[model samples]
Target: MSAYMVGYARVSTNQQDLTAQRNQLNTLGVPEERIYTDHGLTGTNRDRPGLNQALAAVRDGDTLVITKLDRLARSLPDARDIIEELTKKNVKLSIGGSIHDPSDPVGRLLFNVLAMVAEFESDLIRARTREGMQVAKAKGRLRGKQPKLSKNQEAHVVSLYRGGQHTTAEIAELFGVARSTVYRIVQRTPTLN
Candidate 1:
C-alpha cells in the first residue's frame, strides 16, 4: 500500500493562530481531513488528545508530517520515544519536509543528531533563563505572580471558613476569588502551637 501523509499541527496557547501550520500542511497536499491539531497545549505534554488521535489513525505504511521539529516534540527523549514507536509501526516521520525512516541506518543517525542538537538548544535556553532569574532575584525583582487577593481579603476568607459560616465556594464567591484561592488562605494561616 502507498504511504499516506498525515499531518499534525500544535499551538502552545489558544491565542496563537494555527493558520500558518495548516497552510503549510495544505500546501504539502495533506488533505484537510487528515490534518490533526492540538490547540492551547504545550509540546512537552504527551497527554494531548489531538496528538493521540493522530498517532492512533496512522497505518503501517503512513508518513507523519509536522511543520517544525518543535511542533512534534519539545525534548529529545520525547522525540526518540515517538520515533521508536513509529519505527515499530513502520511509519515515516517528516519534519520540515525531511523524511526520516527508523528502518534506515542513515536516517537513524541523522534523526539522532538532529534530536541531540534540539536538546542542546533547549538546555541552553533553560540555562540562560535560570541565569536571568538568578540575576533578577539578586536585584529583588523576581517576586513572581502577585497574589490575587489582598491581605485583609485573605484574612476575611480564613475567618469565614473557620467560623463555619460559609463554604469555600461561598467564601470564594463573596470574595470574588476562586475556591482554590480560599483554600490557599486557609492553608497558609498559622495554627496555634
Candidate 2:
C-alpha cells in the first residue's frame, strides 16, 4: 500500500486565518478528509484534539505534512519533541521551509544546528523580558498585579474581620477576593490578628 499523508493546521485564535496553511497542504494534493484543523487553542497545549486525531490516524511509514514547523508547534522543544515522536513512529515530516530530513546524517547535523539557534533566540527573549521588568520596576512602572479589592473594600473587610462579624469564607465572598487574601490580611495586620 502507498504511504498515507495527513496534514495538520492551527491558528492561535478563532479569528486568525488558517486558510493559508490549509491551502498550502491542499496545493500538495492532500485531501480534505486527511486534513485536521485546530482553531482558537494555544500552541503550547499538548492535548490538542485535532493534532491528536492526525497523529492517531497516521500509520507506520506514513507522511505528516505541515506548512511550517511553527504551524505544528510554538516552542522549539515542542517542535523537536513532536518531530522525534514522528521519527520514532517511522513517520515522515515534511516542512515547507525545509528541503531536508533529520533522519539522514547531514540533515541531522543541520537540524541540530537550527534547533540550537532557535533555542538560543528563545533564551535571549526571556533574558530581555527579565531585564525589561527590572528596568520597569526601577522606574516604578512595574506596579505588580492590581489588588482585586479597592482600598475601601479592604478596610471594610478588615473592619468586619476584626469585629468577628464574618468568617473567612464570608469575607472572601463579600469582597469577591480569595480566601488566601483574607488569611494573609488576618495574619499580617495586628488589628485583624
Candidate 3:
C-alpha cells in the first residue's frame, strides 16, 4: 500500500481560525481533502471527532502531520498516548514538517520536552483564566447569564398560566418566550388554593 500524509488541525475556541494550521499542513505536502479539523474543542478533551478521524485515516507507513505538538495534544500523557498509538500502527508523526523518530533517544527526549511545554502552557492558561474570573466575580463584574424574564414579566407569566384561559404555547407567543420558559415560571410560582 502506498503511504500518504494525513493532517490534523484544531482550534480551542470558535473564535480561533484554522486557516493558518491548514495552510501549514498543505505546505507540508498534505492534500486539502486529507486534512481533518476540530473547532471549539479543547486539546485537553480526548474525545474529538476530527482527531479520531485523522487517526483512523492513517495506515502503516503513512505520516500523521500536525502544525505543532500542542495542536495534536496539550497534555503530556495525551501526547504520549497518541504517539504510542501511531508507533504501534507503524505510522510516523510529522510535527511542523519534521518527522519524529521515536526509536532515537534524542528524538524521544525532544518529543517529551515539547509535550511538557504544551502541558505547562495549558496549565498556565487555565490558572490565569480562573484568577481573572475570580477577580471579576469579586468586583461584581462576572454576573453570569442574566435571566430571560424580569421579575414583573415572571409574575405576569405565572398569573397568565394560573388563569388557565390561555395555553402554554399561546402564553409563550404572547410573551415572545419559549414554552419551556413559561413552564419554568409556572413551576417556581406558588399556587394559590
Candidate 4:
C-alpha cells in the first residue's frame, strides 16, 4: 500500500488558535481531512482523544505529521513513547516536513533535545504562574469568590430562620440563592434567646 500522512495538532488553551499549525500541516502536504486536533489540552497530558485518533489512523507505511515536536508531546518520556509506537507500527514521524528516523543516532538525539526543551519551557511557565498567584495572594488581590449575599441580607436571612416563620427553601427562593446558602447562614449565626 502507498504511504499517506496523518496529521495531529494541539493547543493548550481554548483562546489559542490552531490555524497556524493547520496551515503548516497543509503546507507539509498533509490533507485537511486527515488532520486531527485537540483543543484546550496541554501537551503534558498523554490521554488526549485527538492524539489517540491520529495514532490509530496511521498504519504500517503511513506517516504521522505534526507542525512541531512540542505539539506532539512536551516531556522526553512521552515523546520517546510516541516515537517508539510509531517505529513499532512501521510508521514514520514528520516534524515540519522533516521525517524522524529513530534508527539514526543523530536524529534521535535531536528529537530528545527538542522534547527536553519543550518540557523545560512548560515547567518554567508553571513556576511563573505559581509565583504570580503567590504575589497576588500576598497582596490580598486573590481573595476567593465573593459571598452570594450581603451582610444585611445574611442577617435578615438568619433572622427569618430564627423566627421559624419560613422554610430554608422559601428563604432561598425569596433571595434568589440556594438552600445550602440559607443552611450555611443558619449554621454560622448564633441563636438568640
Candidate 5:
C-alpha cells in the first residue's frame, strides 16, 4: 500500500478559489496527486466525492490533512463524527494549518478544549439570533420567514380550494405560493376558510 499525505480542501461557494489552498498544501510537501478538493460544496456533509475517494485510497499509516477544522466540517458534532470515523479506520488526521496534532497528551488536551470552546461559541450565536428575533417582534417589526400567503390571500385560496374550482398546483401558481401552502389553508375550518 502506498503511504500518502492526503490533503482535503473545500469552499462553500462557486466564487471561492481552491488554488490558494492547493498551493499551501503543495508548499507543505503534500504532492498535488494526494490532494482532494471539493469546490462549491458546503462543509456540512461527509458525502463529498473527492474526500470519500481520498479516504478510501489511504492505508492505515497514511495521513489525512485539512487546512482547518471548519474547512472540514460546519460544527463540532460534525468534526467529532468525522474524527471518530477516521480513528475507527486507523487513519491519521491533521489540521495542517491551524491545529496541532492530537496524538500526544498536550495536543489532545488542547484539541478537546478548543472543540468545547467552538461548541460554546455556536450556542452563543444561536442565542443571539433568538434574542434579536424577540426584540424585532416586540418592536412590531415582522420577524422570521414570511408566510407564503397573506391573511386575505389565504382566505381567497381557501375559497377556491373549497369550491374545487382549481387544482392545488393551479391555486399555488395563481397565489404565487407552494402547493403545500394551498393544502394548509384549504384544510382549515370554514370559519378560517
Candidate 6:
C-alpha cells in the first residue's frame, strides 16, 4: 500500500502558538483532516489525546510527521518507544523535514542521536530551574502559593471550631472554602494572644 502522511502538532502552554506547526504540516501537503493537534499540552505529558488519536489512526506504511522532534516527545525514552512501536507496525517518522527510516543505517543513527539530544535538553532545563529555585530560596524569595484565606478568616475558622457550634464542612461553607482548608486551619498551632 502507498504510504499516507499523517501530521501531529503540539504546544506546551495555552499562550504558545501552534500556527507555525500547522503551517509546516500544510506545506508538507498534509490535508487539514489528517493533521492532529494538542494545544496547551506539554511534550512531557504522555496523555496527549491528539497524539493518541493520530497514532491510532495511522496504519502500516503510513508516515507520521512532526515539525520538530521535541513536538513529538520531550524525552529520549519516550521518543525511542514511539519510534520502535511505529517501526514494528511499518510506519515511518519524519521530523523537521528528515524522514527517519529504520531500514537505513544513517537514518537510525540520526534518530537515536536526536532523541538523546532532546532528552539532554529537557534535563538541562530541569537542572537550571532547580538551581534558580535554590537561589531564590536562599534569598528568601521562593514562596509557595498564597494562602486562600486571610488571617482574620483563619482566626474566625479556628474560633468557630473551638466553639463546637459548627462542623468542618459548616466552617468551610461559611468561609467559602474547602473542608480540607478548614481542617488545615484548625490543625495549625494557635498563636499566643
Best-matching candidate per TM-score: 4
Clashing pairs in 1: none
- Residue 75 alpha-carbon offset, candidate 5, angstroms: 6.2
lDDT of 1: 0.87
TM-score of 3: 0.83
Which has the better TM-score: candidate 1, or candidate 2?
A: 1
Worst 10 residues of 6 by lDDT: 96-105
- Compare the candidates by lDDT and give the number of the best one: 3
User: Which tens-of-lDDT digit does each residue in 31-71 have in candidate 1?
Assistant: 88999999999877888888888898788989898988778
Q: Give TM per candidate.
A: 0.73, 0.64, 0.83, 0.90, 0.58, 0.78
> Once superposed on the true structure, which residue ranges of model 2 sit more than 4 Å away at CA?
10-20, 36-53, 71-90, 97-99, 150-153, 164-184
lDDT of 5 by residue, 19-69 (tens): 988898887668998898888887666688877876676667677777766
- Candidate 6, residues 30-139, lDDT tens digits: the string is 78899999999988998999999989878898889899898988988888788887877788888966788865678778888988898889899999999999999999
How many steric overlaps are in each model, in order? 0, 0, 0, 0, 0, 0
Residue pairs with backbone atoms closer than 3 Å in model 5 (clashes): none
List model 4 lDDT by residue over 98-190, tens digit each.
987665677678778888998898889999999999999999999989999999999999989888999989999999999999999889988
| Residues 19-77 of candidate 2: C-alpha lDDT, one tens digit per residue | 89888888876788899989998666777999999888887778788886556676767
RMSD of 1: 4.4
How well does candidate 5 score on lDDT at residue 114? Answer: 62
Q: Quote the lDDT for 149 in model 3.
A: 92
For model 3, residues 1-193, the per-residue Cα lDDT tens digits are 7999999999999999999999999999999999999999999999999999999999989999999999999999999998888878888889999998665667778888999999999999999999999999999999999989999999999988888999999999999999999998999888888
Residue 45 displacement (Å), model 2: 6.8
Q: Per TM-score, what order, best first?
A: 4, 3, 6, 1, 2, 5
Which candidate, 2 or 6, has the higher lDDT?
A: 6
Indicate the TM-score of model 1. 0.73
Lowest lDDT 10-residue stretch of candidate 3: 101-110
Stronger candidate by lDDT (3 vs 6): 3
